[model samples]
Target chain A: MKLDSRKLKILQAIINDYIMTAEPVGSRTVAKKYNLGISSATVRNEMSDLEEMGFLEQPHTSAGRIPSDKAYRLYVDKLMQVRSLSEQEAEYIKDLYESKIMQLEQVILNTAKVLSEMTNYTSIALAPQLSMVTIKHIQLVPVDKSLALLVVVTSSGILKDTLIHIPEGIDSDYLYKVSNILNAKFRGKTFAQIDIRDLSDIRNELAENQKFFNSLVDVLTTSFREAENREIYLGGTTNIFNFPEYQDIIRARSFLNLMEEKDLLYNILVNSRNGGVKVSIGTENPYEELRGCSIVTATYSLGDRVLGTIGVIGPTRMEYSRAVSIMDHMGKALSRYLTKLYGEQP
Target chain B: MKLDSRKLKILQAIINDYIMTAEPVGSRTVAKKYNLGISSATVRNEMSDLEEMGFLEQPHTSAGRIPSDKAYRLYVDKLMQVRSLSEQEAEYIKDLYESKIMQLEQVILNTAKVLSEMTNYTSIALAPQLSMVTIKHIQLVPVDKSLALLVVVTSSGILKDTLIHIPEGIDSDYLYKVSNILNAKFRGKTFAQIDIRDLSDIRNELAENQKFFNSLVDVLTTSFREAENREIYLGGTTNIFNFPEYQDIIRARSFLNLMEEKDLLYNILVNSRNGGVKVSIGTENPYEELRGCSIVTATYSLGDRVLGTIGVIGPTRMEYSRAVSIMDHMGKALSRYLTKLYGEQP
Candidate 1:
């Protein structure tokens, strides 16, 4: 349905008021608050037209109107004004970036906490993924007669290690030789690029030292596959209960159940995989359980490769323009940090 | 509040029936269902006394009785039936143990999931503490011209690694020498045992290599203090919503807020630090927000030293007997697995 300028202004006023007050908007409320330069009767007529176009809904004939999901989509896409962060909010973001986060996990976790505190909504951040990183080095250290430790360092400065048990009688000298061979063969390659052919070649080279070679390969495979343990840090999950819509216990429980599933969270962030900021409003998400929620997500990258996602979650009635701006700023800040830390530019 | 066997049996029956049905237990219903070898009138008289003693409450003056916090405490302490796992439950536990949980984080995460599934309640597991684990070995591997990786292997087979920057002009040969000295001095000692005094002595021992020695000590000390990142895993948090008490969104939100705080969970587990199973009934928790819930926890150990905790969360009307038995079985199984993995018995 086509909307004229007058109708558009009326719709925008209703959406903005509804977003702020979480109450249905009436012609009188909009006329009094927004000064749209129209009579209440004329404004009411335009609202009725907007409702017919599916941009608004009235709980009852006597009550005011609320923005339908359609209205929210339009507002987010074209009408809403993207607001700059207040001086205080800007300082909070600056403080987060300046604070010394000891590890990548700490960075993501603290980011989520800060977002939730600033916006009063739940926040989630996925740790930087190992697949986006290349193997920089590998080392094996003997722990006991039967156990050895395998350590792998990625180019992005991420460190991971695991313990492997070598067969009895395996000497430290032989272990060191095997470590060097594996490192020489696999260095600078991403895990996804390393294949069975490479494994077979390593095996063939160490044919004379079969047991030690097999154990070393097992340790390397396990260490690289350890990326599956990449965790999603969730902050302010309890904020869901603060919303009036979730005042029903059953609704709150369903939302909590959805949040607990890692796969669900992964899917929610997957749309941001293309290395850009994305906002998914209520009902825009494919999952029915998330129909009442909105997600504002951005991908953090090291150079051109997207590492992972950072996002905030809240009720569909959340401030979309502000959330979008915050996420956009965070993505840029994160990219800059990664470039400095890893000596690469996106 | 002394009670004879007959009065105790009636109270027990009331609690058991109310827990299963989530209904106020009438004397007639308990007398008919439990076959307590007593008439309805006799049961009613005992219930009246139990109420007077603060063990039971009535929704209305004429309604049947429900177990109060004191009643649940009494049941958990002295009346709940402790039973062994069924064959199916035992098989589930065995499967969890047999699965190859490669990382300590995975082990804790999966354990919480399995515990929640088995008991149909919220489950929490704290990760193993590093302060108690002795360093078995340390390796420093050159990652690039500018960086080196620090790998530390603990006695329990957990490997942790951190990336350290190599100072300008430091060669691999000097790094190897420093690594050797670190291995000689720090191996077999906990991070807590290493001090600035020890670093000064080592610095004097290295003489001309003071820069390398100081940098190495800084890296090691930083890695040790980073042990504070140990996480607590929470699973099935939504299960609380299934309880009738949490039907109110306010109550559910309050509970979720309490659970989301890491310090709150850590404190809850640490309070049960005594080397045995613990049952904290409603109002027993030190936190006011958790007063409506009952926490059943057990501290698992590595030999004589307490390592971490495993527990379940449910409403006060929860099945105490089942939760306690499940926690007990898991605690023992986890201890056995860790002992086998570490090659030591607790």
Candidate 2:
């Protein structure tokens, strides 16, 4: 039951064939189609032994064999060679970044779309978590006497704005004084660090505009709460139905339902421990609904901090080497871009 | 081919049956299912007359008839009685808005999701255009000596923020002073109004900090340029596969490709001028790629201003009456919520 070199070759051929055609690979077809320099009988014997060792699976008694989840894991981990992205694909990624000076949110959105369009699989990108980032500045703009817009900027260049209602007769000058005093006292502090104790002195200084000032402080301190609700950007969700495996309504429904749960997707990306390409084959995915699919995720980092993850979801017979390599490249590219954009934190 | 009640009855039955089952409706089947109290021969005669009048089409000589685009138009215009939403469905929309104090962007997002999930069709929502909105307030929050966050509050409560680098040693006080001057001069003005002359006086006032002050003004005036890029929120794009019409990959690809073109979608939403349920059936849709689809859009308003659109894309055989009714109700609900949130612009 040992996986010899010949056995590994047979397994790779089966997986590659299944990924391309979505059909089970028989030894006869492999012998004819692949330059394995082996006899059909020999390939059949290896496939049977591989199945016995759990690397291949036969759907029916007389049918061809397909690679099992264990086989995919083995291939992804050791046997498969990382396919270099085509020059055009690399150029496409480069051009995407260069085409416009996109905000970080737009950049992440475009990355998800490019991945899905290139791989023809559903792509998911988790927006970078902002809770750990410190608050760099808070600005309020006057819309009118009765309302002001609150803008929060993080040190990492993330910007969030919310609208807050103010009491009537609070003039523009009053808002400016409050903004100046608050920034002087509370700048550079994280949301977790700010509380009533830190704001009491500033609150007293703005006693003339006490109600509006208190509301502004409340809005600023709780500002992180809004950004903490990380958005999950999904692209090409319907690409799953293109696969024969998901053509069945029952299977398709499960995947559609699973993709709708943003929290579950976030958890999947968060559960990956390292900032490297990680491939979870079918049955290895923690969620029951996702057991029929395979997911490959690569976490992108900014400086030392891993900010978010980008992933591709496809049928178990996915183009693992290609998806992995593309994801790996994208992750690095995103990390490079983010680092360049925000590395000078001052 | 004079207009008659019998022909209308037969056309309605055919459309209703085809919409529900996606199967062509034979005269015999329609008569039996609809309890029209007509003989098969009489029903068949009426169907033939309706087909001659361009209300129905037969896929094959022997097969049952399906409603044509012309038929759908007639049905939507006159025959189809708007289906009332189920209590559960009504409660879902009510609960969505009540659950959180969502900003307009979030509200549009949730609306897209609710439409797609409820109707099982792809939903699209465009964020309100910012050009028409007047500048209400601006706030500056200091992140550091070399960076500050710019916050723009539009008169309509749309909050936008951006990060700009500043000269080293520029303190929070300088930003507050600049913000106060900008608000004092530019309050209640549009992005169209802010120019160098308006800021020249303020610029001279802050001449000691010329470089930093100029950049602040440049960032503030140019800030609306970014917000002007309208965002298209899409949900349930894959739900197209649930219909038999898009089972072919070519048809599905066309729809997917069409959805990816945000400009095209924005144009489609924008061209619908009036504020009510609008249905574009099949070839009536302006874009070639969308000719196979039907779009049901409802425009949501903020006070008297028509903000943006919310829509559903489905196969031509879509449940028009139901989709229209839901869209109409949701649009009003969104408008009401937005008005309540940002109505008083005093």
Q: Considering every candidate listed, which one attains the maximal lDDT?
A: 2
Instruction: Give one digit per residue, the lDDT tens place, for model 2 in B1-346.
Output: 6868878888888898999999989878977988989888899888888889888899999999999999999999999999888998899889877855537777788889988998899999888877656677676667766767776777567766666778888787777887788778877776666665787888788888778776776666666465454688889977887888877666766677788788999898887747888999999988888877899999988888778889999989989988998998899999898888877555
Q: Choose the strongest candidate by TM-score.
A: 1
Per-prediction TM-score, please?
Answer: 0.94, 0.87
DockQ (CA atoms), all models: 0.68, 0.37
* Cα lDDT tens digits for candidate 1, B1-346: 6887877788898888988988899989988999978889988889999999888999998899999998888888888779999999989989998986556667777889999999989898888777777778777778787677777777766667666777667776777777777778778886667665666666876677566666667766776676654578888888777777777777777777777787889878866878778988878778887877888998777666677899999888889999999999998888777767774412
Which consecutive 10 residues in model 1 chain A have the weakest lDDT in total? A337-346
The docking quality of candidate 2, as DockQ, is 0.37
lDDT of 1 at B300: 73
lDDT for each residue of candidate 2 in A209-267, tens digit (9 for 90 to 100): 77877676667666645546468888888788689887666676668778879999989
C-alpha lDDT (0 to 100) for residue B33 of candidate 2:
86
A69-139 per-residue lDDT for model 1 (tens digits): 88888888999888888899888888888875546667777888888888778888888788778877777
